[model samples]
Target: MFHQPNSEFAVVCRFQGLFPDDIGGYEKHRTRNGGDLGHVDASRSHLNRRVIGNADWAARTIAMIEDMKAENFADEIETLTRRRRKKQLKHRMVEGPRDPWRATRHGPMREVILTANRNWFDAPATSAARAARAQAFEDAARDWLLANFGEDVVHARADLDEQAFHIHAVIVPKVQVELNGTTRWMLQPSKHDLIKNYEAAQDSVGQHFAPLGLARGERRAAAVRKARQTGDEPPAYRQHVRTADWRKAEDTKIVETRAELEQRAEAMIVDEIVLAQREAGMIARENAIEVREQAAAGRERAAETKEQEADAMLAVGQGLAAGAFDIEDRDGTPALVETPEAKPGLLSKLRARMALSSSGRARALHVFSKALARLRKQSRDEAKTAVARDTAEIEAADEKIVEIASRLPDAERRSIGKIRLSLSARIMALTGRNMARETPERGGNDGRP
Candidate 1:
């Protein structure tokens, strides 16, 4: 029941007026207790009355009417006096009626009551949330009145004590009239000009409450008007009314047999299966494209890693070559021999002279041996670290290449296989060179004699 469209249950009433006596009676019913049908309901009534432009109901209603009448009288008198002066200046007779305000009666005060059907508020049962929504609806309605009528709405109230929650807004109809070349406020007899069309008022109300789940009710009059304008026949449903008994009887009949229902279900299933298959194929193609992209990226990363490893290996080799020296003869034949210097530096001469003392020479040799041993150990550790780093990088590159090959298509896989073979050969060559460098005997007489 709550899921049904609210447009069918929405309500917006037209502006209706009340005379002075009627206003007095309504005030009595609202402010005081009288009967069960009165405005007050002791069992279910809640009143949130407010005065918008006056101190109380009397000032807003009866007193406001008297003040407007007095203003109208003064305006009429001013108009007459101006006309008499104009006639005298033109030398024409001013013989119109002297008492324009004598029998003029101020019209009834207009009020529009907006409320929805009872089922709307009662559907969720009586709860704090439901009450809050009802209050919000009333506030929205009041805002609508203030926006459309501005200061004309003198008083407004929301009465929740009745069967259906509703809002009552009293509007004082006043318009500006020109009197003796000066504009003055005068009481309007009716709100006909203000509310020229019922449809527009309904639309305004709908717009104000639309956010609160209140939709504009379907206007049959508008549909009829449209039909006449377009020269089309009115819908048959509008002319026909189905009785409750007939509707109930029709609902009781079985619409489809079990066999037919099964056939319809099977057809629906087949349609769904076809749609699912198409969607699955599209998904597969998209996934294939994504996998290919991932594989390509993996291959690029692996190639970059391989290049980094090669650069590291080259740097290590250069560092080792710079630290070590190759001794060769004048004819370019490898040799190792000592050559005497022409003179000794001051520090070397002092050290040679001190060698005659046994303790000094022993201490100097001991320090030199320790220093050399430290240098050799540091170099070996650095070389081992560099080799380990390169090995890790090469392994990572191989893993990436393998992963890419696994995901690639058959044709692409063959191309990757060839690249893998080339990379494996390069790796083997680098490993063999490193092994030969580590084992001096394996290098033979290449650089040493």
Candidate 2:
């Protein structure tokens, strides 16, 4: 699923070291009990004006995920991000073969990085699992980017630090590169069109004014035919044209109407792209939650075991000392003497007496059971919370997709004027992956593959 980014977000792929750190780094603290904490600037670093008008799906999704992890919890489980305010979670900026932060001090160095950074308060609980998942994710992302963009991606790295997890991609050339005769992008390159310049360039986009060798209306007719058959809107490539109106539009009414239509069309195109991106992210979040649930279940069990052991020791101690359980005993209690039942063994009588007098044998067992139950409840609660959060995020992703597609095309999309809701639906399917779940199709979507 495409990551749901706040309106505060902007896509930042060509980050030249300075931009990313400036926008979204962990806040630094002074001392143990310092003054106000410092935070990273989140202002637009894209250096593009039009992108400011629209938003990028992936960047927004990543931003939301990180912010969610950084929130504070008053009761129950607390995230490390909360424990130490202003201190950004540990981010691994280590340089390695696949690391994105590689340096070329002198000569000439240029590379691409598809990096991701987000804090997860609880890592030890599912470190192994996350690591495994990340490994697989990296491999898949690498292949996916290469396939979508180009094959010039020389290096790819995906890993996690204790506080925040991230991915790094290093490509030799720029994202939009000259491949053979055409151009290609890396890491959701189509998304690159979301850049400010690209959006502006599209504002006045039009054909070369001269008619092509082929029939002018053929493609447009095909688009109309598809729309009629499927009962859906026309695709982005074929839009409503002004063959008749443009010829005689000197009145203010015609001019105003044309301008309004153009703006609406651009808005629609932007919305559709964003919508698809979000749905893809939704599917991915659900999967992450399920994995978290299993991990939480395991931790809950371990914690319960420890609490039980503590109870057992406390119980036996209390029993021996007549409800005065002294933990710091010089020598642990030995069984006391009672009636010699048939004199089965030398210590049988003593063991029996101790067991009878302590009154703890039974009570201790009960205490252990109670402790286990409490811990189990805590663990289950944590799992439920995780699932709840995951559900909300996933649902939001779905909604965002709908809202984006529902928008009418505007001037920003002058050339195509409008993007097909169907195209966005198709791409949103693969956004956040290896995750699961389905949401209601917004508007009047059929929800087909």
| Local distance difference test, each candidate | 0.57, 0.35
> Against the true structure, candidate 1 has what lDDT?
0.57
- Tens-digit lDDT track for model 1 on 351-382? 34443444333322322223223334545565
Candidate 2 lDDT trough over 10 residues, lowest sum? 90-99
lDDT of 2 by residue, 1-449 (tens): 12222222211132222222222221121111222222212232121111111134224433432222212111112222234432322210011001122243321112333323232212225766555544443544455446533533433443232223333443232333443333333222223331223333222121110111111123345666789899998766633333134334445577566656655677787577558657966876988898799879978986766455444434343332231221121133222222223234533433443344343344343232332233345555655576567667666866675566457365543323234345445545643331232221112122121
TM match of model 1 to true structure: 0.43
Model 2, residue 168: distance off in Å is 2.4
Error of 2 at 280 (Å): 52
Q: Cα deviation of 62 in candidate 2 (Å)?
A: 33
